[model samples]
Target: GSFWINAHIEAGKFLWQRSNKTLDSNTRLRTTGQPGDLDSPGDCLSLLVSEDDLEYYPGLPYNPHDCSDNQHYPLCERILQDTQQLLKDPLLVLEETISINIAKMENNVHLILDTIDKSISAH
Candidate 1:
């Protein structure tokens, strides 16, 4: 559970970084009004270096799958899927735990009521 939660947290951080980069790029484009500025040699180099750095990270692996079907970036889509799975795991565990506790509580209640009935009958 902790592992999944940690993975979800890390994925959230990676997604935040990606969105910030996109926002920065968009802001730069809007201010410059020059598409070529976005493809400048320095910008390309920096992008490459940042991507390489991400490769060294444990979480958020880059998926090569085509994201043409979805509006989101491939990595973003994969991260969302992972997040859903991670959330489901914890919920499932909680659900099972609750059911087990409910069963135990029901048994205890039955025993208590039975004991009360016996005491009242003896009186």
Candidate 2:
């Protein structure tokens, strides 16, 4: 979710820079922009870690029934354990994805800068 959101944000920033002819060496790696800047928007992290959303998907130990039925309890418990384990570090995957996306964006920025350098040299 955060990965997609960040990707969209980065893509938007790249496009904005390209359209406005602002993709220069001075452009910094910024997730958020200063007030009045072209990319200045609201917080992205708040969208990632929403308290209200977390309340609906609370995992583990809170299961009220616990699948009391004997036949299904084993399977149910296993599922619960798996979910608990996942919940323990839910953000790990998101963090990794975000890291990868940022790396990709950095690479893209480098490529764009190199192209600009080459074009200016040719002129």
TM-score for each candidate, following the candidate numbering:
0.38, 0.33
By lDDT, the best candidate is 1
Q: Cα deviation of 15 in candidate 1 (Å)?
A: 19
- Show the lowest summed lDDT stretch of 10 residues, model 1: 1-10
lDDT of 1 by residue, 1-123 (tens): 001111111211212322423223322312233343333321211111245435553343322112222322222223355667898999999999999999999999999999999999999
Name the best candidate (by TM-score): 1
Q: What TM-score would you give candidate 1 relative to the actual structure? A: 0.38
Give lDDT tens digits, candidate 2, residues 11-77: 2232221133322212332322332243322212112223543454333111111122232222111
Per-candidate RMSD vs. true structure? 11.8, 23.6
- Scored against the true structure, residue 19 in model 2 reaches a CA lDDT of 30
Question: Candidate 2: misplaced stretches above 4 Å?
Answer: 1-81
Supply every candidate's count of residue pairs whose N, Cα or C atoms clash at under 3 angstroms. 0, 0
